[model samples]
Target: MSTGVSTSTDKIIVDKSRGHRNKAVSKAVRQTRERLQSGHASSSAFDRDVLQMYVTAVLQGAAIMPLFVIIVAALGTYFAEDASLLFWALLTLTCHTANILLARHARTKEITAEAARRWRNLLLAGQFLIGCCWAVFALQDCAACEPSSFTLYKGATLLIALSVTTMSNFMLTPAVLVGFAPAVVALAARSGLSRDILELSLAGVFTVTVVFFNYISDRLFQFSLKILSFQSEKDDLIAELEVAKSMSDEARRRAEEANLAKSRFLASMSHELRTPLNAILGFSEVMSAEVMGPLANPTYKEYAGDIHRSGQHLLDLINEILDLSRIEAGKYELSEEAVSLLDITEDCIGMVQLRARAKNITIHDQVERQLPAIWADEKSMRQVVLNLLSNAVKFTPQGGEINVKVGWTAGGGQYISIRDNGPGIPEDEIPVVLSAFGQGSIAIKSAEQGTGLGLPIVQAILAKHDGQFILKSRLREGTEVIAILPAKRVLQSIPAVEQARPVAKKRRSFA
Candidate 1:
């Protein structure tokens, strides 16, 4: 009932804070994405410092290995009189110089992606160049060697390593695998040993295995991140749905309370109205009979008759209102008993026949010859039939036919159809016909005054009995109302004989 409000100062502060938060989050997200896409830039302190340290360590390690080999080879040349000591010494010196220059260059600044890729490629090219130069010198010593093919194959392996490493720095394993494996094989084949082919095949298999492992690891890491993201989103959506469900439940509870309050208010109003109405009718009847004095003229008597009739009508309306309130409160309970459908139908027709006769309308009863016993409260069934029949009589035109038919159907159900040759309901208004205080479009336009609670009561009663009420109509073709009731109570599992025996014994004792 109350409108929500926000003070101007609070609104301004909230708006400003929200805008600032949105801008900050957007900027941070963009920067993080950009950094992930691009490689490290120059002058980044962390990158320069770490790369420099790593490059220094790598050069130191590279020199130690080559230095050990050079010293060992020199000793071998001196002791065993080997002829290629000069070539071996020059090769070691060249590798040391290249490592020193690379280390110094790395220390100067951070390595950008482009610079890293370029230098990596150049280093691979140098490895191939040095291997080829050594192989060429070996070929000259052994004339049977085809040194050019081996050199070309080694160059291809180096190119593959460079390409793979550029694609991903994490591809280090694959890069090292492809780079060295083929070169080792080429070296073996050039040596002209009989087992060299087997060694080359093993190296090829080893390289493929390394690449396979790297691919599987990369895929696994990606899949893990994706699964975590999916679960987080699912949890957030479930939380939102739970909040919506709680809000809906609260709204439903409030609606039910409002409906109960309305029913209670109507019941109280009806009670208050009926009290004064009874006194008015009672005093009018006394005056009409001249308990105090006789009417002065015949016209006065006619006026009194109108007042009595109107009073009765108002009483009927009040009773209908009270009955509807009881139905809404679920205070109208059915007391099951055996009653014949034929009897009820005939009785209802007899009650409303005079009203039909007043309008020259014929009330017809076509009850089935062998109607089954229905389980219901006899008084309530009487009310249901009377209300329907009376309503039919009120709406029937002169010479119009009112039909009441009863029959036993299959599935152990009894049906009573009440039909009348009256203006039928509009098709679109059919759904609202049973709703409380709602009427058909045609009914609204007509002069007939009704509380509009009759069908709602009928529906509620039928629902209590676990039965059904159906309406079918067409414009200018009359309307049919069907009430279906089960032949038996479908009582709980307690035996009927056990229930009857107690009543029979009591009757015998009384007798």
Candidate 2:
């Protein structure tokens, strides 16, 4: 199997089972939530909410309806001749009382979707009984008054009742219809049999009024339904957000634990691994130098030199890994002091100068005069500079050029820039190279491969000092890495105040 040069840290897991069990579970949860919000015929949450609104409205208006009927009956005793009007008012009040008790009881019960139907029917039945009382009220002729006047009186009372019911019970469409439709039909039937033209006209007008208000009531019902739907949708969205938050928290906890475990393992094994590495380096160096005596076989001497170089390379890789792990674990503390960027850069260049000379690479150093010392970790800064310079020397082709610069930043800070005219990193692969152990295609194919920790270490060190790290590169153009220390980190030296020595004359004047 041939592996690709570029790599990613993501992991993909595939699970194939009978119905994709995980998806099935999620789908079930979604469908159940939707059903609870939308179901109407059954006792769903929507039905229960609407029913609760209806019950509450009826209970609130319970006393008003009785007060109205008693006042109208008292007025009838003076205006009309019918003694039966008092009895009708009493009966209507009784029906109102029954409905109020029923509504109050329903309000106290837990009405779910399953029981919403039963509760609604009971409420509608109570309302239909009230409509029967209104039907009886429509029959009173008020024989003591003029025929036309009585007709107007009857029509006006019915209109008021229709308006009241439509307002109080509009949430339930059936309640409105059963509460008032019987009275409209009764008045129409009574006026037709009497064959009175004036009475018939008033009755027709009353019917139209009832129809118009019912239409308005329907619009109210739709609007209320829309409001309820919006409310249900809001509740579901809040639930989903809560679930997502919990899942995110869980995943974060797991990631932190795994990272902690990795740090512990690396820390514990560091000493054990380095001890053997030191022994290997010592033995290989002794053999390569032949310090005890000269080797008889030339092939043996060549092998010893290879062993020494390989051991040194392994030691370097081990050190880089441990440094990166410590940085990630937040255990790498900065021993901060005032350090000069020019001095550090110059020293790093010297350290890599022999390697660059072996490859015929020219390094040009540019320094801004009078650069300020920055408060930062000295050892970490040296590591950052050396890693960048080493990379430049390793990648720059024979006789290529590298430019190094140290200068004051525009924001009264300091920066170190290292640029190499080698095979530049592909723009898309810059992130890959910056990640831990993430080598780009160029690095993977290079003759001198690296552990891919150089830039990451440099970035981490700069971050510890509250500085910035920027890497810019293009395909075959060049690569430049800038490490910037903020203005706050630049230790600006204070000018000492110059003052002449105070003369002793003040003491003589006091004496």
Candidate 3:
């Protein structure tokens, strides 16, 4: 117990010493939780990761982008018979291909948080270059077709291109605006030059549509960021929980090892301690009794008697420590047999009777007769009875009453209960008193004190027998302790077998 206690204490001290590490982990977790709760989960630290995803997305749809550009140009050239549309298509394809090459190169390179802004600026620049190609396309006049129809066709082409850019490049925050805003501005400018009302209205509607798509793109990016943040938080929580579990397991294992070492040390040293102790007791007893010769001085005999009593006390303490250690170490093996619970309780009462008489304490015992013997260790039962009786005697005031009971339990088990009208323990200190080497306020104030292993040993012994030990106490009222044996341990009387006499004569007469 000492070694285990020390080890736990040391671990606590070490944990305190390294509390900074725990605080840092807690801080990160706290910040993450705050961000989520405050609806600010889109951390700037994840920008690099988002950019990486954006680069991959743009490169994936690279072939399709150039195809759309060529198709739009070809459609316009068919309707308008314009060579300018062809040149515009060629220029757009070149710009779109360059953008693909840039994104692919960025993907191959290591993208770090520090380099994220640089890469982002570079990609936005490429988008603006492609937007320039769209601006040039917006200006191509359709001379071979009706003016209104060509305007419609041109408007449709620009809208389609803007829609495609928005839906695909929404992962990047400014991509939709950078790639299409230039074209929208060019259309507005062309409408202003024409000085027509419908053209101005069309230009205004195009600007509004562009703004709406950009807003939608930003919202989608936010939604994706929120989902990623949640995933990252979950992963961190699980990892921390695993680490905590591992630390707990390690601490438990180390504590067990320390307890084992303590038990082993105590077991090995018990004999080394008791051998000299035995000689001291023997010699002191002889001197106190004056077996060989009478003592010259009364004080000398008194000193010898004191020595004997002190040695006995030391022996008792050692025995209690060893018993508790064995029980805690799971090494206490019970010697089982049929023992009369009633008989054992009576004997222990008698043993403590003289001490009760010394204090003028009256003991009232109630015994239920016709009780069967129970399957238990006789020595353990005796020890259990004695410990309860001894505790009753120690706490009982002079002229106080002690009640000892042996009876059948409600569940058909055997129970021995000892109650004393003494200064009872406080409700809070009951647990403390029940622990090893713990004492209550009453015990601390009294002349009588013990190693405090008595109740614990009794509890452990009952547990081994598959029984139960209960202590009930109230402040300034009284205390009662009950030790119960389960019904399985109750040995019932076996009925005798009746023998058949002269059975052969009856069998001969039977059909």
Model 1 lDDT tens row, 388-423: 787677766789999988876576678888999888
Candidate 2: regions farther than 4 A off: 1-45, 108-110, 498-500, 503-511
Question: Highest TM-score: which candidate?
Answer: 2
lDDT of each: 0.61, 0.83, 0.85
Cα misplacement distance, residue 511 of candidate 1 (Å): 52
**Superior candidate under TM-score, 1 versus 3:** 3
How do the residues 1-511 of candidate 2 rate in per-residue lDDT, one tens digit apiece? 2222122321211112223543554665576477556643222446888899999888878888898898878877778967788999999999999989999999899997799989989998999999999999888877679988877877788888888889999888767678887888888899889989977887788888878888888889888887887776676667766656655665566577578556655765676677888888898788879998889998888998888888889889889999999988898999989989889999899999999999999999989979878888899999999988888888788999999999988989899999998888998898898888888888779747778888899889999889999999887877898999999999888999999898876555554
The Cα RMSD in angstroms, rounded to one decimal, for candidate 3 relative to the true structure is 5.1
What is the descending lDDT order?
3, 2, 1
User: Candidate 1 clash total?
Assistant: 0
TM-score of candidate 2 versus the correct structure, residues matched by position? 0.87
Q: How many pairs of residues collide in model 3?
A: 0
Clashing residue pairs, backbone N/CA/C < 3 A, model 2: 43-113, 43-114, 44-113
Weakest ten-residue segment in model 1 by summed lDDT: 165-174
